[model samples]
Target chain A: MNVIYTDNNATTQVAPEVLEEMLPYFSNQYGNPSSIHSFGGNVGKKIEEARSKIASLLGASSNEIVLTSCGTESDSTAILAALNSNPEKKHIVTTRVEHPAVKNLYEHLSRKGYRATFVPVDKDGNIDMEYLLKNLTGDTAMVSIMWANNETGVIFPIPEIAEEVKERGIVFHTDAVQAVGKIPINLAEVNVDMLSLSGHKLHAPKGVGVLYVRKGTKFSPFMIGGHQENGRRGGTENTASIIALGKAAELAAAHLDEENTRVKTLRDKLETELLKRVPNCIINGDRGNRLPNTTSIAFEYVEGESILMMMDQYGICASSGSACTSGSLEPSHVLRAMGVPFTAAHGSIRFSLSIYNTEEEIDFIIEKLPPIIERLRNMSPFWQEMKKKSA
Target chain B: MWDYTDKVKDHFLNPRNVGEIEDADGVGDVGSLACGDALKLFLKLDEHKRIKDAKFQTFGCASAIASSSALTEMIKGLTLEEAKKISNENIAEYLGGLPKEKMHCSVMGRDALEKAISHIKGEEEKKIEGEIVCECFGVTDREIERAVRENHLTSIKDVTDYVKAGGGCQNCHEKIQAIIDGILGVERPAKKEAPKLTNIQKIRLIEETLEREITPTLKKDGGDIALIDVDGDRVLVKLRGTCASCSKSELTLKHYVESKLRELVAPELEVEEVQ
Candidate 1:
């Protein structure tokens, strides 16, 4: 079975080059960077090299890069740190469509006496800037927004929102986990004070992430263990993973152009073909302004898990509206928030491509998916009854 | 992904007797588009009152499709009476047991079969006649109450799974819960109910508790729970959908809900894990 991975938004495979760069740190350069020996000195230099590479991707100073375990920790750190930094500011400004890494944390914080204003989004999953601006107040301590949504792939106007928040001197942070490699982001050009990225989202290993805390941003550490990460995070460095992340950053920067063109073509082809071949299908997000490689499609009258499982028989790995919240009978909250009816929302499937997905794979999916829908619809009581109702 | 039987996979991949049989002897269709999954089964009965051919079209997920496929396959050559005997459990068993969450897919299949049978009998569709309480799925107050009486539904969430009452918009959960309370006469607040001591009462209580609390939680998981029996406080229960025989069943039962039940009702209710 040829495995075609279309779940890049969930995580990406580690690129060979990134893995090659990390191997030595596990074996030869095994000394702790904090050690005062030649082996340690070599590891220390490599960590700095990695930090500089990561910093370049975000257009932030190298000193601002604080290594963390994963994107969630980075988000938890940034949000909680900002709240802790400003003790008197009780209000938090965020969007309703944020990843649970941000949304759940905000809700948790809200339960703890912190007032949260969850700004709503339009039907396209785009946050209303005017609503966000109207909600901001003197008591607002921070504005936590994401660069790109994981489900719908809708890109927020982060820089503009940041500029608006920055004018008021309110701390601004973005969970840019899905945006870093797929989009061009430079802290120098954008006014965002803090940003989070996950190594696994790119072609790097999991359990490795970076938080770019811009200079002059009031910051406090969420994890208070050691003097590591410049006393910003308190654990021993995940040395090997961090080194791999740096190499991945270099590859991401170099391959950005190819990814945008190549992956985008495959994605567009998949969406266009499925839309054309399958009747009653609709694209879920902002078509033109969203991620180049992400497409969320809702096949009317068919649930997502059935489509995904049938696709899996062909070794096509993708995600679905019903699959993520597998235990929760609810359809995708992201879709629900976008005002997509339950009929369509539960049937939505997300095909998130990376540079590795080929045209042949997309073609195979195009061939396989329609039959799956047809087959599922044939047994659908609702569709049968719907025809009866209509007739 | 759900653990579909090869039979289910085969049916899902190449469903038999697909599409609508136009101008058929009888057509039985149940569910609404808003119900997330629905089935319409068409039957052509022979002179002997046997179903010679059955075709179906469904609007749902994998299990729904497979269930419809399985239903058509199961009913071929069966007498009308024999076909009527086919239960949702029989259809699910034909597919080597469906995921509990996807069990509704099978239920949809059964509803379609019953409706088809009813249609052939010259009865108009048995639409639940009452006030439309659940605006999301158009479930009626009588329908919600009936599910409560038949399925022993204890909560609004259970009512949603059995009949898709409050699955959408969720504006009618309280209304559905009110129906369950009215029908079951469950006066103790779900949080304040005491655990039953006798076997039958314990079983009844377990069903009541599930109808009330566990169904909502399981419905949230794209699944549902049913009370099998009560061996003292050792409640023998069957898990469905993603939860059925799942690896996390213990954690889900022991830690998540059972702990809550212990805190609320009986501290000694032993929820034994069953297939």
Candidate 2:
């Protein structure tokens, strides 16, 4: 069976070009960047070159970028550094719909003598900017928010938020792990104090991420060890992944136009046709201001895991915010936070596309998905009840 | 990403007895849309009181649908008395075995079967008998106790896996633990008698109690406490951060902190704020 990979939000397939670029780093060019020898000195230069590529993609300075193991590390380093830098300040602000990388950390902070204000989101997955502004205080150490939500693909107004946070002298951070490659970001134009991007979310191999800290931002290190990442983060670099991420960034920059045009068209077509064909289904986010390559659709009355299982039979990969899929009793926090009805929340399916996806794949999904939904609905007791009530 | 058995996959892909049994002798519905799963079981009995036909309509994950399908197949030829004896374990065993977390799917099947049997016998549906424990999932103490005893569940997580009792908010973990302890017949540790102390020993103990018992809970609410002095039976302390600004600091000190100290230390001790 031919694999139709549409679960890019979870992780993307590593681009072949990125793998080719990283092959030499793992074998022939395996010198530690920290060593003083010429062989190692050459590796240090390559690392700087890689850093510059990633920096260019984000419109940031090479010096501002700190490479870490993954997006979670970048988030931890940013948030913890803000708290540690201003130990006297015991308050933090975030949204209720953040990725666990930031949400769990904020929750942990709340348990450890910090006041955490979780700004709410409306049913369309739009944040309450007034609530966010009102929550900011002199005692707030940091405000961490995601640029684009992982499950809903709803884009937040980060630049405007950053400006407000900076005016109040509060450190602002954005988890752009899902936003960086798919959406255009010019950090030089935005006043964000810190931003996190994961390599694997694009077409790079896993286990590498970048944390961009503005030049004047107060800094404290999370991983205390030998001098690495300019002492902002520690341990020897994941050399191969770093190299691959650099190549992926360059490709992402080149493919940005294709992502917005072709990929967006495919995503829209898939979403539009599925909704047209399937009865009683609803989209779960602000359709206008969302990531170009993602769609979250909730097929009412049928469970999402069952839909995913049926899709899996045809080698079509996708994901769900359903309770059963997450091993939790409630649905996705993003859906619940947006006040999506329980009838729809438990059946939300997220299909995130990548540049590699073709129109044929989208068409194939459109053909296959409606019947699956119909079949599951036929088996659902809720569906029968709904039909009977309507009748 | 669940490691579902081949039997489970087969049952889910080609579910058995999928439909409503019109003019059925008994019908039972369990779970709800809010709980992320629901099942409706229908049974048609012959003149001899044997199940002539059984069918189900389910809204759930693969294992749940499969469990419901398996239940209908299992009860098709059995008498009502024989069907009443079917346990969740038997339903799970029929499908080779379900994932530990997916055991609740099997439990849903058993609950529907029991309800259907009760419906046929003209019995009142079992009322929620005990106080609600886990408010997030609306799981009652009776439900938790029954799941614990039947599944031989040992941990709060196991109970969650079997019945989704402590799966959300988790405010009722301590209560769930108490229930599990009651069922397991584990003796509660005997309370240690308060040790007699000199002035220095008393001060040290008071400080230790504040640090170990009182401070962490206060910290969770963005507050902190400091031991100022221990004079006679009175323990003086200072509140900081949100506690200092809070209108309920006195209540916290007199009720929460003081009560905890009295329980852990000498019962005659009185707590006061230095400020």
Give each candidate's interface RMSD in Å.
Answer: 3.5, 0.6
- After superposition, the stretches of candidate 2 with alpha carbons farther than 4 Å from their true spots are B190-275
- Residue A116's lDDT within candidate 1 is 94
- Using DockQ as the measure, the top candidate is 2
Per-residue CA lDDT of model 2 for B1-275, tens digit only, reads 98999999999999999999889889999999999999999999999999999999999999999999999999988999999999999999999999999999999999999999999998998898899998888889998899998989999999999889989888999899999999999878867866788888777878888899889999999999988888899998999989999999988998998998888877788899988
lDDT of 2 by residue, A110-190 (tens): 998899999999999999999999999989999999999999899999999999999999999999999988889998899
Residue pairs in collision within model 2: none
Candidate 1 at A230: error in angstroms? Answer: 2.3
Kindly list the per-residue Cα lDDT of model 1 for residues A330-386, writing each as its tens digit: 677788778887778878999899988889999999998898887676566555556
* CAPRI class of candidate 1: acceptable
User: Considering summed lDDT, which 10 consecutive residues are worst modelled in model 2 chain B?
Assistant: B186-195
**Local error of candidate 1 at residue A197 (angstroms):** 1.2
Reference-based TM-score of each model: 0.77, 0.89
Residue-by-residue lDDT tens digits, candidate 1, B145-217: 7656755667666665566667767787777777777787766455755545666655565667778877897
Top candidate, metric TM-score: 2
